[model samples]
Target: MTSLSTVLKESWGLVEDRQDRVAQHFYARLFLSDPQLRDLFPVQMDVQRGRLLGAIVSAVQNFDSPEDIDGYLRSLGRDHRKFHVTPEHYSQVKVALIDAIRAHAGERWNAVYEQAWNDVYDHIAAQMIAGAAEDTEPPYRHAEVIHHERRGADIAVFTCRPLQPLKFRAGQYVSLECHYQPRLWRTYSIANAPREDGTLEFHVRAAGGGWVSSALVRRLKAGDMLRIAAPMGSMTLDPQSRRDIVFVTGGTGLAPVKALLDELTRYNRTRFIHLFRGERQDDDFYDRRHLDEIAESCPWLTIVRAVSDEQGYPGERGAIPDVVSRHGPWRDHDFYVAGSGAMVNATLRRLTEMRIPSTRIKYDAFTDA
Candidate 1:
């Protein structure tokens, strides 16, 4: 019997040999056959090809151990959710990939090569389908930037067009693509829920090192055309469920949670919402007044602001997990943690220790750093 390890190793070697060629063929076929997918790709084919090939290489190499395979596949499934990749797309890519492999391997390629590649593609496609089933199409008809308010320092609030039409459930995010840098993109959650018109909004903090973000801060203006990917995330209000919702965030991570709160208020669902927001200081915080207004309007919504660098705040004074342990109702509430990787990982660990099931926790790490 050919073990998974053996097959995976051979697959990796085969892929490494022809990864670039496979990527080229894949893009050529996709663009030639499906103009829509071609439009989805950045104009710079080489850069996009490199990214796709690198991702495939990483995916195959990570499967060297069976233990690493499942997690790696699942992560791809989740990532593909945002891409809106379907079974058809997977099939197209698979055919192109296998053909490229055969071309590169020539006489050396045999039944073993066919079987291994088939197995890998099948596993990836199934997981992607599973992820797609859980996501819903975005409700907003059109998105446009109407108002841009500069908050203290690097923070700003962009009130968008379509006004307040449909409510964006808290914890859901919208992918933003800039015209100048089409390949560079970022996702920001709505800071407020639907009000009257169909307008959506976002709270963005300028990351100096981020190409797209810095461009948004410096060059983007009202009436600028911005492409937005559909909203897809697991973190949102569960109306039928009555579990407490703990929202822990840092920086602009507050956007999605605020959207969630808007939905909760609209439906008059009174689930306890604990919002733990961390920033460098009070000045670094955005939407304090709006959050306070929401707290005032909804008695069940408890907003806790944590300034990590400031000493004077009476509420939880340090990291989110510390505040969570001190004042959280973890036993009864589902948790939605967002922000930097370190903060999310720390909060996840604390939640696990607090005996909250992993299934009850949802998170979106905005930045890998």
Candidate 2:
């Protein structure tokens, strides 16, 4: 018998090029079958359309790796609690997904592929349901903005206090929804560690078509309220490993990195930490003052500033990966990278080129809200 992964991958390849069409068909069928489900999504379907296909692609890509994919599915399942997704919804999605695949696969669709997809969807649904059930925290929290500061023309730094405690590791991220962008949720890293006052800090940049990010950066104020979902992601510190660390950050990617650093300052006594923050222009370096303050007090920490697309910069120049490369011999050190997809991909490529082991590297890449 052909393995489930093999069948799923082959079937996925058949419809991958027509992802948008598949997603559209799937959602259409989903909404038609159960019109009430339409209320769960945003008014604008553009970004939401991409997210559905993205999740499917991710699942298909890791089909062969049960352990790897199971963790992801569980986290996804837990996160979907914010949408109030039930097991019945999973069944509806599975039906729509299979229909979508069949519609797009045309003459290539087969019973083997259908059975494989059904089996895999069952597994995925089971895992997600289990994950959601295992989680004890609430699906979302109501948070009141306590502070908001515009750091640049496009960037804003804000802090919010959740009505209930939000337990999260320093390097994890949480999805947030605001009234201004109803039903649209955007993930942002918590810029601070778990605070005594139950405050969470986030740094956001308004991208061209990012509705939620625009609202966050431009319209959100001290009294505004945000609905934040449970924390997710695994790019966190390893308490067991005391390996010297290197952190690479670009743009507003500094949020999680700063959170990790803040946590490290409390308990890290030995690891020599190097933080390299890069920006396109000198003026875009927003968190230098706090970083400099930390570096001054912690002799174990070193800060390197880099500016690309700017001429005659006093500090290191060029892309973040290039700057990091110049300071290398980092093969023995654990690395954490956070940035835009392009930035993270570039850094990952550089790290791979330099023969850094995958186990030693952790990263989080964010898309526009």
Please state every model's RMSD to the true fold in angstroms. Answer: 5.9, 1.4
Go through the candidates in order and give each one's C-alpha lDDT. 0.69, 0.91
Q: Estimate the overall C-alpha local distance difference test score of candidate 1.
A: 0.69
lDDT tens readout by residue for model 2, 254-313? 999999999999988889999999899999999788889999999999999999988988
Question: Over 4 Å off in model 1, which ranges?
Answer: 1-40, 43-114, 122-142, 162-168, 311-315
TM-score, candidate number 1:
0.71
lDDT of residue 127 for candidate 2 = 94
- In candidate 2, position 105 carries an lDDT of 94
Worst 10 residues of 2 by lDDT: 53-62
Best by lDDT: 2
Error of 1 at 353 (Å): 1.7
